[model samples]
Target: MHRTPCTVHGTDDRDVTTVCRCGCGEALPAAPAGGGRAPLYASPACRQRAHRRRRPVAPTTPADPPSVAPLLAQVRELAAVLDAGGRPDPTGVRVVEDLTGRLLARARSRGQTRWLPWVDAAGRERTALDDGDVEALTARLYADGARTVGPPQPSRPACARWVQAWRRDTSPGAQTYAPLELVPGYPLTEVDARVLVQGCRDGGESWASIAARAGVPVAEARTRWG
Candidate 1:
């Protein structure tokens, strides 16, 4: 390690003592009337203090650059598009929005819900609709004795009251079994309200999920809408 000694042109500089090259701030002998080489340091100790050698740091290897495979693939796709000798669809903005919505989900309120999109065994993406695919699935599950559908247990550790909790094969074919909602007091509802029925159906709840939440047979949930 090595360090260069700090120097300042101390000749005729009035503030040389205050701005000492070695940071000592001690006064120096006044420069001779004849201009000459200036004092380089305020004192011998200051000279040693100002000339500390800095340790050499080891050089770090640069990070590897991003892989080029994706970029090359995108360029090849663009070349094929150019070879087609036509511009892409002018109306394809809608497709971009659709794909973006599928790829990036927006934040939703607790009260809001969206329909379930599933990829069946056939590898095609499809939206699950109530009263149709939903009903068919529920009928199949109910017949299979998936009676483990019911309201959530009370949040408190110990309850004087007991509520039946769904505890069985809640698997993929039946979709996810998220406990419908936390019904604090008790599960009470207008037994046969048309608006209520319509609202529940439109709320993206499959009959299977609704039945499990209502603690009823999935068949009963399906027939209730019928």
Candidate 2:
């Protein structure tokens, strides 16, 4: 290849000129007199470097490590939103929960923990809750033996499942199952409680027994049962 510029004598004329893309301040050689695609690199080494830079990167697996502080902070924010909403946002909660679950699972697989300080609502600095706590909370959101009654849907909390069970058991001509009474100190909806009390009476269970089981006086049970 000719290394000299092909310029007419006594004239400042050139075919083409361009800069290299690799941050190296070098001019690419001019193309021939007839028009053609200009070179993108000053040398073969720069061309090879540019090619390597554009190669596809492999997809990352779930076990990839993440920054601990930001992940924890994100989890805390999600938890705070759940708390402040008073009504749960299941999707947001699940997102952070799954993120933390994967992080902890990866740590456990390597037989180590990534320790970071976390502050609780009581303003005490402590380690994050263990898998057991998450398990317990997760269990509380689902009733044992609950199954889909319709097409696929998002998960419902255990309370929702309980209420569904209660409604089905109390419906006229509906097959009965074990009762899922309301939690103490928080009565079921007025209608659900009424149905429950009436169902008990119709089942030949005495008002006194029903009252005792419900942690209420017999008179209150009779009044509600009507």
Give the C-alpha lDDT of model 1.
0.43
Candidates' RMSD to native: 19.1, 22.3
Worst 10 residues of 2 by lDDT: 112-121
Compute each candidate's TM-score over C-alphas. 0.21, 0.24
- Candidate 2 residue pairs in backbone clash: 141-158
Question: Candidate 1, after superposition: displacement of residue 185 in Å?
Answer: 9.4
Relative to the true structure, candidate 1 reaches a TM of 0.21
lDDT of 2 at 30: 77
> Per-residue alpha-carbon lDDT of model 2 for 72-123, expressed as tens digits?
7667777787678766568767767666654554343233111111223344
Residue range 14-60, candidate 1, lDDT tens digits = 45444546656677656657999776676777777777633456799
